[model samples]
Target: MIKIGDFNKLKVKRKADFGYFLDGKTNNTKDDILLHNRLLGKNNINIGDEVKAFIFKDSEDRIAATLIEPKAKVGEIAMLKVVAHTKIGSFIDIGLPKDILVPFKARTYDLEKGEKYPFYIYVDKSNRLAATTDIDTYLTTDHEYNVGDTVTGVVYGFQTNNSAMIVVNNKYAGVILHNEYFTELKPGQELNLKVIKIYEDGKLGLSPRQNRKEELDVLESSIMSYLEGNDGFMRFNDKSTPEEIYTVFNSSKKNFKRALGVLMKKNLIIQNSEGTYLK
Candidate 1:
């Protein structure tokens, strides 16, 4: 049986003026997949020769065969680039002459052009190659992965509370909760994250936070450097909003305040309701 969107070892049924037709093994010549000459590369072939081919659909949605290995296959996860975005769906580059469709219904979030995201490739009901961002069904939590382990994840969706839904290493279910919010996040963004907590249901809670003391030191240096560059003073104080502080320092309020307290206790800066000033 010839499975579309996958590799198949098919015997060459016949030679055509344009290309060779690979037997689909369905006993129906009508189902014979085409292996175009341009796709043959450096391989020489003749009638009755068996060749391994990657089967997929062309721009006309007709079944075609290629010896070129695709970036991914059906039932596999791969980071695919969105080459085009349409109201109906997006198209992803699978390293083929024709890109694959990621239908709107197949995605958990709207995909943008030029953005790359991990997608679960599958053959839709129509037997057409398709991609999707909702990879939770393909994810697993049963593994040796543990808390505090450094991992990478791609932002895919958001929760009602503004938490980020993540696919850890494109395999495990993970989330960045609302409390761990930092800089702005968007779909298709790759983040180097840490496994902070594992829930009873086995869902992983992830964080982008670095070591606390080290983070404080970095934030302190960032602030002192900014103050020195900005005439040695800034009108910001501990009462400043986290958003404002983060905009200026790219740090959370907790780290910002801690750095300020450390600086103040050392008499390096003085603060009041109005503002903080370098002393």
Candidate 2:
């Protein structure tokens, strides 16, 4: 019942100059795991002393335990930095001596060295620790989340239709449809998303924007800043295209117009066929 890739509590059977041999619960030294000298961690352990450690295979493929914690364990998600690459896959530094492998097929983009990305760790078919950017298979749609609830998530992949696939709370499946944002989102970007709708299939539809009033507050402030920086006069108006509005404000045309309307109502600005200008 020795579970690799997880923390295990084992008793010391014997000690050696190299390290202590942990009892594998089988009463056999050959079946014992070696807690190497470097992993002793200042503890003067003796036989029959119970110690907790993370069990894994060492460089020699021998069962080993360490007091050091990995950045992420199997069945968990973490942000890891790419340190090196091979023809078959890339390795990420996961706070362990052996970097975890992220195969090319499991990557959303061509991973480059020195770049950090969100990766989900799991045991591969060979029972070796591996990571992947394709995390949908690990995400569940059934969750207790409700509309309007705020949750944290990471962008793992993009749909061909331009939607962003998100894993919410590291477990629930969610997405931000193409119409939700004016800017392009990339993989591995973390977001604090607001749940907009819970689909019939239990999937969540999320948005990055807040409610209308709160959105207007932000947009209004943005407009004021732009006007202030522009000497109180600007040329963009209702005639501006969506792309133009997005380029200037990083917001949708509808939100831009709503912000303009509020400004005009406050008598802070006036608009004509030519453009909008501060009064």
Candidate 3:
């Protein structure tokens, strides 16, 4: 059967002035789908020649076939660029003659032209192809990724508490929870992230940076900021209680010591029995 919103290899049944009619493989007379003249991509099609084409509804809401492969097909996800918009919806460039609509109701935020978003493609209630950015329901936790694996994603949505929700590899569900990274993330931003943990529910926890040297650099910077905020004197040291270290550093005692050690090695700070102070 020829399924709309998918690719179908249909035999050319006959030729007409407008274009060739493709056999829908169904007995119904109305089952013949059209491969319109404008959509016939340079191929000299003959009757009985099977043409592999993407099937979709044309502007007139009639079934049609095109040689143009869309950015995504039914039940698949992809990053699609916004091309135009109307009061009701935003049109996406899916590499088709007719842009696919991401209905206003399906959008999670205001759509902007030229911006690309990870979208889920599906046939809407009207059986017409559409794209949607509100895709959390389409994401699944059944993934092959493991901790420490490098992955890329686009920021699609945000949690109420400022966590960034990401669409990983345009399919999997991933997130960088609040305060996971120091930088504030915005929608449509693409990021290269590292998988930090896989939850019991299979959701992925991600981090923006991972190298030990890079982590140390960030920690050192945070320590300097803390010292600057406290008049260049921090009343804590390696000998301080873990609770005291955590209260001041917002990190584990071990990490605090590492940052302090780096600062000491560089002679950027002086540690005495009284406390640690900037040199």
Candidate 4:
């Protein structure tokens, strides 16, 4: 049985000057399938040979089979190798007889051949399967997000402001602000970040810094280790200056004070007019 918009393996029942004819029953009627000559030029296909064909619509609105596989469906991500380039666009070999086009307008920069690029496969207004290099413009979903929401992203490039340009879920390109960056980041790096904001223009904001739970845990652990390693005593008065606290813990004075407060709350230490000491 033949169905529209489906893949089918059919046998070549006959041949003609224009193409080969395939026999298959569709809705209990004998239908003739046209496999164009130009489409089989690369292969030596002959009568009685089984071939795979994708059902496509003809100009007469009839179901026709093509030797070319189906085009990339919407919302599909694929890694394709660059095959050639033209002034208007680059062609990518996406496991199909016909290469997909990546238009110049869809690119952030010029592309070169012999390189592999990950792209979201989409059909353009012209009904052609094309690749997009500028992915940020495509992620325009009405999804609600907020600060401290854990998300994953891939580093794409760097910003002059010291922020890292990242791609999230191949849907959006967002900036991880410099101040929010806590560790080293490089291009192609895949890391987890917290969503700092969802801009009105559909761009996402990310932060590499720890969230509340992680920050608290790190602070507590650092303070406990510092206190235990130092004979259970920390000069927490005027002598433990902000600079000294930062040098010791890589944290601000306020965070040091909060860690001290946690130690006091846990009855692990005591503070006096003289200085903070072990109880």
- How many clashes show up per model? 0, 0, 0, 0
Cα lDDT of model 3 by residue, 1-279, tens digit: 668899988889989999989998888758799898988877889999999999999899988899767778999888889999898899998887788999988899877799888888999888889988889999888899999999998899999998999889878899998766656577788999999999999999998865767777877998889889999998788788876765656655777788899999999998888888989
Cα lDDT tens digits, model 1, 170-265, are: 678889998786788988899999999998878889998888988898888988898888888898889999889988999888889999999988
**lDDT values, one for every candidate:** 0.88, 0.84, 0.86, 0.69
Per-model root-mean-square deviation over C-alphas? 2.2, 2.3, 5.2, 9.8
lDDT of 2 by residue, 1-279 (tens): 877778888888888889888888785668989998888766777888898877776667677887778888888877789999998899998776677789989887877789777788887776677899887787889799999899997787888998999888777889999999777787777888999999898999999888899988998998889889999878898789998899988888998898899889899999999888999
* Model 3 Cα shift for residue 32 (angstroms): 2.5
lDDT (Cα, tens digit) per residue for candidate 4, span 201-259: 75688877676667767987887777788887776643477767666677666666777
Ranking by TM-score: 1, 2, 3, 4
Candidate 2 off by > 4 Å: 25-28, 41-44
lDDT of 3: 0.86
- Could you tell which candidate, 3 or 4, scores higher by TM-score? 3
lDDT comparison, 2 vs 3, better candidate? 3
RMSD of 3: 5.2
Better of 2 and 3 by TM-score: 2
Alpha carbon lDDT of residue 180, candidate 3?
68
Off by over 4 Å in 4: 1-148, 230-253, 269-279
Is 1 or 2 the stronger prediction by lDDT?
Answer: 1
